[model samples]
Target: MPPRTSLPRRAAKSPALRKIAVVLALVLAYQLWLVVQAQGKVGPGVGAQRDARGRFAVDVELGFAPERFHILRLQKHGRIAGTDGHVVHLRGVAPAGVDALAREYWIRHIEVPRRGS
Candidate 1:
């Protein structure tokens, strides 16, 4: 009778396969780091100022012009109060909407609007 060999055991013994696996793991780790960095773009207390309607105001500083269009698309209910250079003042943004904005790599920063000008 012939003995059956396991495919996983064979893969574990191959140096090329081990190298490929290590590279894939490193790539995945880098991707996760990027996600964390992107989410960190949101400033402290930015999401803490929800109004009675559960919407907040934020100053979204973008990396470029086209990103403004993407932000407008992501925030359908939010209105652009003003824009100074690449910074856009968005109001009526829900918590979920803010999270979505944070996930965008093109968005450089998200912060609570200041009291005055």
Candidate 2:
């Protein structure tokens, strides 16, 4: 004889759930569209420059290409580190109080780290 087994039960599907799912999907799609549009071009809200001490201060859009300045990493708390072993900060502009993220940035005279994410 074979041993008996029972499968776990799942909640019954509801029309409300389906509607919610559809709405969420649509909202997500819209957000993705915005991101794609932003990626196509850097907005006026975007910019990057070195300070008097050769440190960096930036207020670039999320999709801003880091390849132009070779920015290695945008650290937490507005600190951005470059490939030159020096840390910089973004001045005059931030993501409107939102935390800044380290994305693709380009610059010159810098060394990129070879390991780790």
Candidate 3:
């Protein structure tokens, strides 16, 4: 039998290229939106301070509406316990803009600190 001639092969393009690009663009837009939301924004929040009794106490309040704050107590304390016998004392009133700011802050900060020092 005679030798077989070699056939030309078509150059390959990644089939998933378009899908990957779309995903990247969407992620970028979401991140930009979050930045715009958090920039120079002072949302309603309370800062906690540990008292001599080792109880978490929130002092000082910053927000737009006081009555809408629904804060019966300016400072509230809570005790958190772990299954492994770990206990954490936490105190704070739920902030007004916490729901909206939480997402923006989390995305921008990437991780939350145990406490702001």
Candidate 4:
């Protein structure tokens, strides 16, 4: 019998294992890209303008028309004040809730509501 060899040496010698490893790596990279893309959709100063109760008022712009499911998801973080076209107005959202809402794929952008709008 031969002496024990390292795991990297064995994997390197097998083309099948190398292919599996490459595929797995690519899959991981794609998942990471999705997370980054979601995070980037959040606008600057989102969680900055909070009310006295430490709740935020924001307008979430969606990639598509607002639906019941979308409203429900937003309601998880705050109350849905109204919806206009692709934008949904949310109030009473906490700072941590803003981060969680930003991770939704359908949410294109989340920003503080404009004045006098």
- Top lDDT: which candidate number? 4
What is the TM-score of candidate 1?
0.65
Model 2 misses residue 72 by how many Å? 32
| Residue range 72-106, candidate 4, lDDT tens digits | 99999999989889999998999888878877767
What RMSD does each model have against the real structure?
Answer: 4.0, 14.0, 13.3, 3.1
Local accuracy of candidate 3 as per-residue lDDT tens digits, 11-94: 124446657778999999998877676554432233333356533322222232323122332212232221111211224324
Please report, in order, the local distance difference test score of every candidate based on alpha carbons.
0.80, 0.39, 0.36, 0.86
Between candidates 2 and 4, name the one with more favorable lDDT.
4
Model 1 Cα shift for residue 65 (angstroms) = 3.0
TM-scores, all candidates, are: 0.65, 0.34, 0.31, 0.71
Candidate 2 TM-score, C-alpha based: 0.34
Off by over 4 Å in 1: 1-3, 10-31, 66-68
Q: Which structure among the candidates has the greatest TM-score? A: 4
Q: For candidate 1, what is the total of clashing residue pairs?
A: 0
Ranking under TM-score, best-scoring first?
4, 1, 2, 3
The lDDT of model 4 is: 0.86
- Model 3, 26: alpha-carbon shift in Å? 0.8
Which has the better TM-score: candidate 1, or candidate 2?
A: 1
Model 2 / residue 90 / CA error / Å: 14
lDDT of 1 at 91: 91
lDDT of 3: 0.36
